[model samples]
Target chain A: MAIIFSSLNIAFSQNNDQGQLSGNFSVDAQVYKEDLDIGAEVPVEKMGLNSYANFLYTRGNFTAGIRYEGYMNAMLGFDSRYDGVGIPYRFITYRNDNLEITVGNFYEQFGSGLIFRSYEDKSLGIDNAIDGLRIKLNPYKGVYLKGFTGKQRSFFDFGPGIVRGMDGELFINEIFETLNNAKSQFILGGSFVSKYQKDEHVTLNLPENIGAFAGRFTFMRGGFNLSGEYAYKYADPHPDDPSGLYNYNTKFGDVILLNTTYSAKGLGVYLSVKRVDNMSFRSDINATLNDLQINYIPGITKTHTYSLASMYPYASQPNGEIGLQAEVIYNFSKGTALGGKYGTNVSVNFSRVNSLEVKPTANLDRFETEYFAIGDELYFQDFNIKVHKKINSKWKADVSYLNIIYNKDVIQGLAGYGTIYSNVGIVDVTYKLKPRHTLRMEVQALFTKQDHGDWSMGLLEYTIAPKWFINVSDQYNHGNSEKKNHYYNIAAGYKKGANRIQLGYGRQRAGIVCVGGICRNVPASSGFNISITSSF
Target chain B: MKKFIVVILFLSIGISLFSQSKNVPNVHIKNLNGEIVNAPDLFDGESLVILSFWATWCKPCIKELDAYNENIVDWAEETGVKLFAISVDNARSMSRVAPFVNGRGWENLDFYLDANEDFKRAMNVINVPHTLLLDGNGKILWQHTSYAEGDEYELYEAIKEQSAK
Candidate 1:
């Protein structure tokens, strides 16, 4: 080990003509008690720590680096196989001109990460780094091609499967360089990917060849832009349902995104609709959670940052779901009746998702269909409107209302009763007392007859910029069939340069934590918490 | 009926207590190969130990290990440390552990396995590629939840402070 370290130093010094080396490290530790009854099945009752270090030496186009990770006690809601110390990613890749190649662990995403997304989410305990060879070729001005073959990362090991993929994209404006200054700019691309695994079957016959293809086109012309992608996957069967009853055959998923903006003034409007079916593409048909995931499905719902607003976030059902969302933003002219002195911003958004209705036939299975029709009933719906205005030179105000209909039994696979209808209203106000001091207050109320019932919340925040901030909030479920639940939290944070410390004492309710498009169920608890992060 | 009610009450309270959050348990155990040995002893004053939890079948884990093997020497010299690469391979494949490490030529890392999962459970490990950094006194100073290619530089900076301290 000592010899290896010496050699590395010498090599880095020799390669780095400037003789400079840099690295960084971080640690995430959590301590809490577990409630075994109504919470998640698995819980961590002790202090868990996960840490890692990274070192990189770069000189020009060449870059080299390695990382060491140590999981003293892994956190709950994570896979247990991550409790070792080792380097998970290392490589030295160089780029000269338009051709670049890398051999080792690397993360890549293809086209909005719909069909393929190999990345890392530290907090979620997901790292799907591909270990193999990757090559990128730019033969001409507007054409690019990428090819790679590797195995998907599974916990501390690799899945018993291999993946190979190739993608090509052409920029229309670049292809016709003379059209660069044209009124319309366009781009088009296509990609194909396939995964292979040995099949040992006896009862049912399954296709060993599984392939997926996608093509995208985008056009922009003066405040108007449109983009669309059509993706399809071949037939694939799993052993879990050997009868091919719940399997997917010849599945197809497509997304069409249209964006237009007239920034000449102060107003913006965006609308989009997407329909997907049987696209839960995975490397291993049997793998679940942080396993051999081969593709990603985007959730069409808005991500709420507030505690109560995020309570009922929707998770994308990859198998079959139809989503529609439309949003409009308008800013009134300043010093007008609706705008006030600083002007007013108003936004309205509506989104709804429903399950794909399917009718079973005597001779044909459900999986054989390419497009499943929508059911008669709706699965989920949300309509919200928000208004933000600067009331005065030292004061600002925001108000919003949301109406939602959520189906617990269908959406969340939890054993429950009927649908829930909720109406929520929020009012927020902020006052600037001084240059570095500000105070904010929020009041919210939720009225519902199903699930947890009616609720009320209040939050206060005090901030001293570049130094400290404190927040206190409480949520009370005053109306419910069962027991009334009350949740409260008080947190303070201090920041200096690149270092920050946060401490909080609070009682929280059980809910789902969703990042990107993935979701995890987090239980409820009351405890004191502290976290410190610093970088030098 | 009374016993059943008590059980229900206990379960309900337990669920309610942890209904909103999860707890990661902590335990003390030894990383055993063919013999039993305490893990704390491995961290001497000379160098900080980078304990990474991984398995032979996990490709990402292997990628991380291979990455470390390729740059183990440089990391050691830059931060003056060593890596304690432990495998969470169960008893069924425990015998295959040493050979896999040898094949990778991971000489800079001391190979060990927690076949029984006692060490894993004690460490509250929920996933692979989990890592921890322990000071010479065996106290955990810094840690990270996951790994990326450039994350090692951040880890090295953390260790340099502890080593200097």
Candidate 2:
């Protein structure tokens, strides 16, 4: 640990004009303790640590970078395959005259990322960067093109497949002078991605080459905007038993997504609808649990901030699902009747997802489903409303309410348990005691008759200007008398410039943790933790 | 480990011996119109630029932006400073950013979307609500991570001081 800190410190302090040396480092370590009351099982090491450092250098039109990651025994929720230390990512790029070329590992996305997106999310323990070559060309003023050929990263190595893709985008307003100042702007884009794997399986034949294509369009006029994408995939078959996400079947896949938004001075409205059927595209047919994924299907649901409200978050089902989401935001003037002195902002959102209605065909490996029909199986539904108001110079508050209908059996892949209906409410208040001192308090309550019954949580945080902060929070499950557990935590941190250090100790509840709709399960545990982050 | 430290030190010392100009990298981002714009080009070399990296799902980010929105009018008029809010929302929640910002009545501020976090990586930012202050020449003057209630005042003071210089 000292060695890591010392190296990072040296890198942070060194600065010169020959070229810019900029990098960032972070270290997160935890010490586990035994607590049988929460069904916590200690690991063999009894400690876990995750650390990463990124060094990026840029000179003229050239940039190079590398990321070093180490997971000492891995964390509770993270995959155990990342148990070693190595430099898993490295890339070099050069840009000039509207042409950019990159070699090594890089992340790329085409259009809305429905059919092809390569990215890295540390929180989700996902990094599917492609290792090969990528090129971007802007031949004309309004035309942009991208092409790449690479292999997906798979935990310290590369997947057993070769992926290639090409994308083109055109901005109509810029292409023709006649539409330069048009109120209605138009943009069109398309992408084609394919993966190649070996055919080494017996008893069943597989198409060694599987390809997916996507097309998207955007229309905008003043305050109204509309965008949509349609994608189709060739027959991709994988053999996995009854326990995997993709069963042993051979079928084509397709998806369509539509979204629209309208906004004015103080009002905004958004609506989105999507349908997905057998669209799970992966570089490796045998990989599971967020491994070697070649495409991304966005979850069309609101991501709640409150702990209880997010207790039963929705995860995108790529195999087959129909989802719709709508939201409205309105702000009243400062002196209006409902706006009070400081005005009020209110937003209402609702989202629902259901399984795709499919009927078996004469072929055992294929099923048929209508494009717009929804299945009877309910996957997840959430309706939430939030209001934010500033009472005075020193007082501000935010209140939110959420009603959720979660199908645990489907979302969490469990059995026996049916749907879990829950209602949650939260109130957060902030008070400025003095010039540089502020305090915030939040109280949340969740009521439900299923699952773990009901839950309540409270948190208090105090901060002093741009330096120090302390917070204490507790979540209590009082609805279950048989096993009432209290998950309490206390932490403090200090921040200066681009550096922050935080230390905490608490009992963690076992549940699904998600970031941007990607999720992973974490086991309950008790531990002391510390994290340090700094960038130069 | 000792050998690794030696190599890193050698590289740092060797690299520090050279010199070059410093300026914001020209990273491509998208405006509300879905057209690509060079992020560094926004700095016109005449006014202070404040770039705030935020996401729709983050709470403190909203609070910080709201605080700035209240006083940005006065600040801009007085010091000729500009504020640009960059949303790092991925595809899952990118569509809501526009509505969320307009709903909060923050239309006065310029908004850009870094859907793939290209600008974020170039700046070496780790978390949302990370604020950076750039001079007229696009050189980074000051930066801070996280936000509290009164942090905006400090930023405003920094702006005043730098503009005076």
Candidate 3:
């Protein structure tokens, strides 16, 4: 790599005391063509890249890091076994005053991660880092502990299963000191993950040590808050299962979650609920899709950054479902009456999902559920609303509305597209035009009569603040009765201080591209792109 | 590839034989009532701080935190500086970040939540309307990563040039 960046640029100009060396870099390339009326395809390395870089190095308490990823032939729905790359991730750590340790690759989450969570999300190309030991402790003064035993990356190699976990938490008023002036507060946690693969199936006889467990809690006071978690696992069946939608059923799985919140001064509210069943904890259980996902099913809806209201999004199925979501927001102060003169927010959201009642037993490979029932098929629903406003000082706006239904045969398993209602609307605006210039506009539509029925989009942007920007967009389907493609794009960008670069030309629309609710499946092309980012 | 060049020449010779450190690296975020909090105890060595690193479906990180919530109370009564904002919003949008920051009233910015980004990978933030500018013992005297529209007046002139040193 160019002699390791000229020996780290000559040890970064003879170093500033040798340790701190922050990191960050990104790349994204594309060049494809060959559009056959939107069924775009053209690979054979017609051009595609996806690079990454991370270098980290601290000092006090010691730290070390490395990450370099490349996917010269893996973009356009990623996963080409990530073509080529190395340095999957590296790490080393050491801490003090309360102990901390790490030994190679990491990323973790326990409490609300359901059972466990190892992270990374280069826009849904997921990382799932976790390669060896990890430890964290505080020993008291509010307690907190963690442990690990990794093996889960599966792309640049690793993932034949061998994961272990542990977690702990507590903070009932920072471990009682007269409850720290108590005003209602508490936290509690617990977790225990497990895995170990090696059953090389040959007539079924699995369960090579699988385990899972969870518990969580939280509660606050002023302005209310709540939290919850639950988990359980044991029977995980796989052997030759690649999204055959799980069927070697040995059952035993579970999940549950809850969330709540409330606010004051200008309103705010939230709610969440989940159920999942047969959790689908992967770590190579014949991993599939955003692979090796050892927990993370959140997605109770409401994550739509509009683009035709995120076109029927709401993955989070994890085998079985049962969801919920709610939101509020408000605001509206500046001179009341739906707040105007620069104060008017709004919000309002809703969500739903279903299916999870289960039935059938008597030794047919296990099947029984009912605890917290709720099923009748209908996997997804949404309702949205937004407002946001600011008039003077150069105008601002953002209107919104959504109402999806989706269930395209249980979320894209597509089969005669069962339910697919839709209804979207948007309108953005900006306009500053001077103080460093700016202008923006957007208008969207999405009504539907069923699969690929109606759609419309538009955008226009211009900026010149801290750097520059340019945008152009289009998206039409105009109630396609057969075919009515029209997905255009034009982009430009520039930024300094931390660097950034962008360029584009496009027409790419093949669906499913999520992050957070995790998803991926971008196909359809006609491109020319470039992106770059940096940090130091 | 030769074990990746001997693991990059043994981590660049153990990063040129280590030695350097500053503030902001205790990582462990969560405020907004979820508690936790411990990112260098929100710097206090003497003043001037400003984190950022946003999310909630980033839109220029809600327009650079709504322009620092419209001038963070005259920049914290003229130079007390503070601004936090964190929020990497994982777990699928982290329960809509406290009703999207109280429906965008932004209540004078302070939110937190790094959900699994672990203080955004211990401050090497990979993207999300970044922004930093510590001082008060935490070092980092200026950082930026994306966000336009008058970039908050050059981050309040780099916090009034580091609070006039």
Candidate 4:
């Protein structure tokens, strides 16, 4: 293996048209030292590493690639199911003007992913890439059709169920040349997906086949645009969840999503709504948490990056939830009182999610729900406004305020931890010493009486030109009447071309680290971490 | 165990002969109006293009965009470079990318959404705030991962170096 890899690396040169080959490698590892003070238990191996390398060889109209991942005992927050090493992804592809085909491992999605989506997110420890066959055909102009049949990956293995999906899309405007020139454009799409698994339980009979269908449409013109999708799923009863709150009774599912936006020049407004009911489609019947999600319902609220503002983020509820999100963006013109010499940008956003107003009857296959009814229980709400401006050539600042009602018990499954009602404020500033050097700082605070009480955080970062950076930050649970634990970290990074290396030593607070709408719980720990990534 | 390591290494570099700047894959991404455009078309092979791969939910991504916007006029006037901010937001948050960019009044930048992450996976991007500098010939001359407070200065330098050539 070493001989082959060395040969390839040395053999490839600046020679261009000879069917180029490309790939990248990355590795992240952490060495743990038992910290009794912070409850960072020592792993049996004393260390954990996660590494992956992808190689793709493309020539002419054909391409093939493979990904190898190694997790030495897995990371602390990662799923232990990925304890070993294996080649989890590989694919061969061929494409032409009329048709495209792929075999082996692939990722795909239909419309808003209400019915089916196969993708990977290493941060969330979620990779459900399908292993099988996929085909795409454009038989007619302005029309796209795709179909796939495969089994979803579970850790190092494939799920027992075999899932299949088909999607078709037609651009109305393009299909009809007359409409193409019209001011308003339209697009129509539909999808059908299903799963089949063997029924093996002896005590209870279960449906081995579950299917869903969805249709979507969009219209856009000028500054106004609108789109929506409706989906329905066959009866799927799973009463054996770990929580034991759901009934094993047969149940059907449905979801509806609508979004609209209007924008021109410096002002824009957007509104989105989603309704989900009994929509817990999964590759595995009993998969829990961040595992086996066939469909993703992302958070409608803003994604806050400030340490304090994002402390308690909203988690999307794919099953039996209704949500609405609204946002407005306006830029005050330059040279105005509010705009200053440089224009000032102000953005306001609001989002809310609640339980669906649905009731179940004694019927064997049906549930009841009003089309627009909203449940009384509140899951999450976020209201925030931010203003950003450049004070001078060398200085810039941004200030933001956020109000949130986070249901920890419902979202994080913390039984006794009630909903947290908090308000957070943050100020970020950047100063440039020279054209090649700069410094940035952030100060943030959160006020709340629930959970860990009030909190505050501060961060400072310095950068030299493009290749070097160093930073330090700390968050304190100051509102806690008893414990005032400090979560602190210091890190640095160096970059050259497509290669980057980062090192850090820090104490992380025990909490849920979420990306997109998925999350992973990380335990409290103090350790040294190193990461190396390069692309060619 | 040694054999396994060797197999892994071989699989990673089995076909790599020498390292060269590979062209951006011909993946498809959608613009704000939901029109599919080839990924390489953004650069078009005739102009210096800066592709800033970002997401609405990412803070550093936003910061980098803001900084670039603040310096865009100057950057363009000085180097005749155009910037395209590609939002790698999936189906869940894709609807917000356009609105977010529009609301910020960053009209200086163009926005495209990668709904399924095809471009991201094809580009081998593991994180956001990853920026790529392309020459007039559509060759990716330089790329960087992560953003610091003053990374734009280095980017400008790279742009100047490319434009000079």
Instruction: Give the winner by DockQ.
Output: 2
**DockQ (C-alpha) of model 3?**
0.25
The 0-to-1 C-alpha lDDT of every candidate, in the order given, reads 0.64, 0.89, 0.83, 0.82
Candidate 1 has what TM-score?
A: 0.71
Q: List residue ranges in candidate 1 displaced over 4 A.
A: A1-24, A34-45, A239-245, A248-264, A363-373, B1-165
By descending lDDT, how would the candidates be arranged?
A: 2, 3, 4, 1
| Native-to-model Cα distance after best TM-score fit, residue B109 in candidate 2, in Å | 1.3
- How high is each candidate's TM-score? 0.71, 0.95, 0.33, 0.93
By TM-score, the best candidate is 2
* Model 4 C-alpha lDDT per residue in residues A86-154, reported as the tens digit of each score: 999999988766688999999998998888988888877889999999999888878989999999999
Q: How well is each residue in B1-165 modelled by candidate 1, as lDDT tens digits? A: 667666755654564444221111111222322323455456665577777887754544754675576566887887778888778654223333444454334556777776544344334344566666766544455665434333455566677887788
Tens digits of per-residue lDDT, candidate 3, A1-536, equal 85777557644752444456777889999899998998998998799999988887676677788988988878888888887878899988888758889998999998778768989888788888898999999888888898999898888998888889889899889888998878999888888998888888877788887889998888888888888888998888774344343667788888888888888878888888889888878877777767888888877887787678888787887778988888888888898777866678878888888989878778766778898779898888898888888888998888988888988776766677699888899999888978888888999999999888999999998988787899999999989989989998999998877788999999988888887777787888888999998877
Sequence-dependent TM-score of model 3? 0.33
Interface RMSD of 4: 4.9
Q: Write the per-residue lDDT of candidate 3 for residues B1-165, one digit (tens) a residue.
A: 778778877776686566444556766788877777778888878888889888888777998898898898898899998988888888777756876787677888888898889778777778888898888767777888888778889889889977987
How much is the lDDT of residue A470 in candidate 4? Answer: 89
What C-alpha RMSD separates each model from the true structure? 19.3, 4.4, 25.8, 4.8
Q: Give one digit per residue, the lDDT tens place, for model 4 in B1-165.
A: 788877866654554344232355657788898877777567655668898899987877888998898788898988889988889888777887766777788878888888888887877777887898877544567888888667887788899998898
